[model samples]
Target chain A: MHRLILLLALFGYLPAFTQYKPLDASTINRIKEGVAEAARTTNTISSDFTQEKEMTILKDRILTSGKFFFKKEQQLRWEYTHPFSYTIVIRDDEITIRDEGEVRSFNTQANRVFAEVNRIIIGSVRGTLLDDTGFKASYTQSNGNYIVRLTPLLVTLQESLQEIVIYFSKADFTVDKLELFEPAGDFTRITFSTKKLNQPLSNEIFSLY
Target chain B: MRSFLFTSIGLLLLLSGCQSIPPRHLTPVSHHLPSDTFLPTAHCTLPTFFSPPTFQRALFKASMDIREHHLTGLLFIKMIPQLRSSRCDNDTVSLPAYRIVCSNELGMTYFDLEVAPGVFRLNYCFEPLNKNALWRILETDFRLLLSPEAGTTPIKTFVQEESNYLVCKSKQGGISRWDLYSPMGDTLLEVRGKSSLADPSWISYAEYHREFPFRINISNPLIKLKLSLSLLSLN
Candidate 1:
């Protein structure tokens, strides 16, 4: 959905003018290396996710749950199972979206925001967020999870997105939860569970006519 | 010279005569109440739609089709009351009413407005939708949709037409709304227009909620646009 992707872009943060405190160099290096190692073994991943969109004005959160899939070399599928029927699949630089029996396909280059969101989603899944120099990152640990807080540096991005907070399960270094906070204080939280790693996935699963 | 001046004025008047109100039309209209059942009430009861209950708030899953642009999102509508300088004619001072806010699921605000006796304030609107023409259209639609004064003040007229439909037309401030009701006195349709004009870019309401018809569809044929809304929750 363009809306969902736009929401993702609306939540994106790049390192520019931010108040985020940088972690020590040693701590940052360790996290970058650890995430890289863990992602290398994750050839494919399939997980169930629950997304909660909290709107502060109405003081309510809308809930939607779906299935997510990611494969190496830029392939992803996100499908919602309830409230409404919608599906989005990204293979390489192409994006295919199906809504109410209408299937539309377009290249990621068509929309800058969409492309950025695609990059961030794929990067998050593959633990490659450390590769993006646009965001200032801070690392912290609590309980059994490692947390990373990303803040945008540019004024324009800072106006749109406040922060991107990600939580990693210390056991396997896998992402457990992702939160996108907007400048208006509204936020979206996505929690992943029942993840399967390195399992073979057919290319047909990303097919959409 | 005098003759030439008179001719210019005559031409201007002729050109102005060609201008007229926008067209109004409807379908599935073969059913309506008979004209003989026409009646009048001291004050209109149909205006309660404009004045919602105390702390009125509702959530809706909304889909809007504006030309080629299609948008689907959750809509939140809240009515907050305010104490105000009353606008009253004669000895009866009008009571203040609530302000209405419309926003999407992500808290992106659409517009904030209020309509009460001698009060109409449009506080905010999304920039892209704030164009003079578009905003005029939206303002007219909301005014027609939410103005209680439209159905209260003027000389009220009611007529039942073919198809067992009772039509009530209320006029105030040159604005008029024809509220079509079923035989059971339930509102089925509301069409707004200029009081003196047959068709003034009319907007219509349909597909009311089952119980009180809270969920409804609004369509403007002139713009070829439709907005569908379904109640999700109430607070």
Candidate 2:
């Protein structure tokens, strides 16, 4: 009787141990496959975006509305229409800013601060951030949506960026929102609307003034 | 040619007479001094209030044309003494990314560039003014230089050397010469300078035309920027 009771206790504890086990190898492989699929599906993206910057130090926030275009292989353009007319274009690691006939060009590799910002922006549009080797990502399912939380592994990147949370629709895997939190108590939240994916975006669109 | 020579000789003698007056000794009088009565004594005592006396809380609209850049825009300026006291409330439709502030006291303005993340300050001179070491020359006999009422004794009188020149001498040992001609001489708007004696001296002179608004120019040799101002409206 004593031996039977010990056997029953051991058998009951096995299920709990299996329940607490870490995500299996197959589960890890599935996340990688999903990320790769998302990247392949997005070739070109064009959208009308509204950028709102809220400075933690000031009471008033600045709002800017513009049209953004991105093509695979690193071509991007942002044109602001209201409150001012300004254009910024990125082509082959060069950023061009044209404001009221004053044009300035800066090479990405020359400015380290700007280069980091550009990398994040380009990676987001290309869906390459999902596979960013500098960060570790985990997906959580909540409210019928998939939330990907990315934590930087490198010290410098971690100093500037605490984490980046991306929300996507689970059914179609379409990105809807992104939140980037800086270590210095500042954060930028961007929500996308009127998004057109896999559109026929021309290379000339990025080059036009 | 013979008649012209006679006239020239006679004019030279008259000018010499004007400059030869003997200096007179009179007690320095401050009652009629513009420096004594014009600006409030409290303002001068409290050095921090060193801003323009007029248009402290007024609204102004003007058109700015930058000749170098060939850029023209309509600018609206609102000055409020309370709340946003330090900055000029400006709204420009053309350059939507920035706000501009024009100082009435300092006679300077700055552009707050928001979108591009920068700031640019532009200096304007409305009248010729000096604010550094040069202002000392004006205060040596401030009571006499700026007095609206000329004293009783005309210690010296100026007679025209020619149709275009006059010389005058004061009892306190000051001399002035005036040249009158439309083509040969351009009437300058104002002269400004800083006092040689004061620690931080700024002086301004404004020349007003009978029909049009006045011109003001400011020079600060110590500072690199010079300013010019055109009166858009008197009110």
Candidate 3:
């Protein structure tokens, strides 16, 4: 009877302890290999982006169309061409935003929030999102797409963002959609279409105006 | 020594009592109008008008530095008969539209278009004042207190007095009063009233500076919107 009671207690606590156990060595190696393969396969990423922002105060949702350009070694540019003209370029550790004729630049290291955003964007582009220790990731296969759901580990991030869901094409593992949900019931859904991978891109494309 | 100490303490207490005495209250002047008549119509009309010869339409552009937020934008306005008209075809224009018609006798404004598409109708009646008074009223009341309408009427007006003043009340509960000086005060424009139908009870105010046409100060009881408008000439 004593042995049975001890066994039952141990079984009850085993599930909780196993919840955060490290991924198996083989799984970790597979993820790294997949990331390396994706990085090498994708030299330049160009895609048409459609962003929908649902504002909390306004009943209407704003639809914006833009183009996204990305190159290896963390160079990205988001150029909005319709509805209004705005461009956000991230090169190295600096971000420059140009709207109309005005230009504003800020360093990622100086702005912690922007730095985190840069890291997440870079990680997502490189298929290394699973390496971010600040989030717990679970993958699901849906409609020939890999859906990665990231839940924030920190309370502050969790308060602002409930979850970030990223969808990548299963055929080539290219990110096609990213949905961010804010705690205030607001959401931003960005969809990528006509994605061209491994295109030749010049460094001048990321130059600030 | 005991006698001397008691006398000093009594004198100190008396002095403290004199210092703590309440200030004399005087009866305030009864400037409130009777229940039947809230606003006085004595100085109902403005004195005169300063008519410029030609009406020019130009695209105005400016950059605003609003604290830390900067904005730039362009506005196209046409100086019409007695009113400054703006094109309302674009949904980007944020303010209301009004048709301002000024004649020798009175100045009339038509508010809330679409019922009578672009038709000018009599709205507010401004009695004629002198050119100086008109300039003062324009600077103080019309230019500053009123918002530049894109499709709505300017409803509120102000008349400046020494310290105490009378204000006409709008049916929507907005108050209009004019100042004694220029049409555009230190601040080019000032708008004070509830802007939206949702919050009819709340009072909001906006101030625009002539020097910085791109910057605006908007404040309500709850929040403040310091908007900067930067204009990039697409031309």
Q: Which parts of model 3 are misplaced by more than 4 Å?
A: A1-35, A55-59, B1-156, B159-189, B192-225, B229-235
lDDT of 1 by residue, A1-209 (tens): 99998877766743222324455778777777878888888889899988887766546666777888888878999887655566789998998877667787888776443565577678876888867887887787656667798886766556446788888877888888888776656677888999999899888878877
Ranking by DockQ: 1, 2, 3
TM-score of each: 0.69, 0.44, 0.49
lDDT by residue (B97-133, candidate 1, tens digit) is: 5455554432344555666555566666544456665
Model with the higher lDDT, candidate 2 or 3: 3
Chain B in candidate 2 has what TM-score? 0.25
- Per-model CA lDDT versus the true structure: 0.63, 0.44, 0.49
Model 3 misses residue A55 by how many Å?
4.1
Task: Give chain B TM-scores in order.
Answer: 0.66, 0.25, 0.28
Q: Write the per-residue lDDT of candidate 3 for residues A92-152, one digit (tens) a residue.
A: 8998877666788888786444566677777888877777899998765455565677888
Candidate 2 residue B21 C-alpha distance from true site, Å: 41
| lDDT value for model 3 | 0.49
Model 2, B1-235: lDDT tens per residue? 9999999877755654443222223222232234444322211110111123332211122222222211111122222222222244554222112222232110111121111112122222112232322223223212221221123235322223233221223322222212111211233222222222121112233554553324433333332233344444432
lDDT of 3 by residue, B43-140 (tens): 32221111122222222232323234333333222333323345665434223232222211000111111101233233322221223322322222
The digit string of per-residue lDDT tens for model 2 on A1-117 reads 999999999998987665434444575466556656766788777777665533333232334567777788888787766434667788878977665566767787864434655
In model 2, the Cα lDDT at residue B203 comes to 24
Positional deviation of residue B88's Cα in model 3 after best superposition, in angstroms: 39
**Which is the better candidate, 1 or 2, if ranked by lDDT?**
1
Q: Model 2 chain A: which ten-residue window has the lowest total lDDT?
A: A53-62
The DockQ score of candidate 2 comes to 0.02
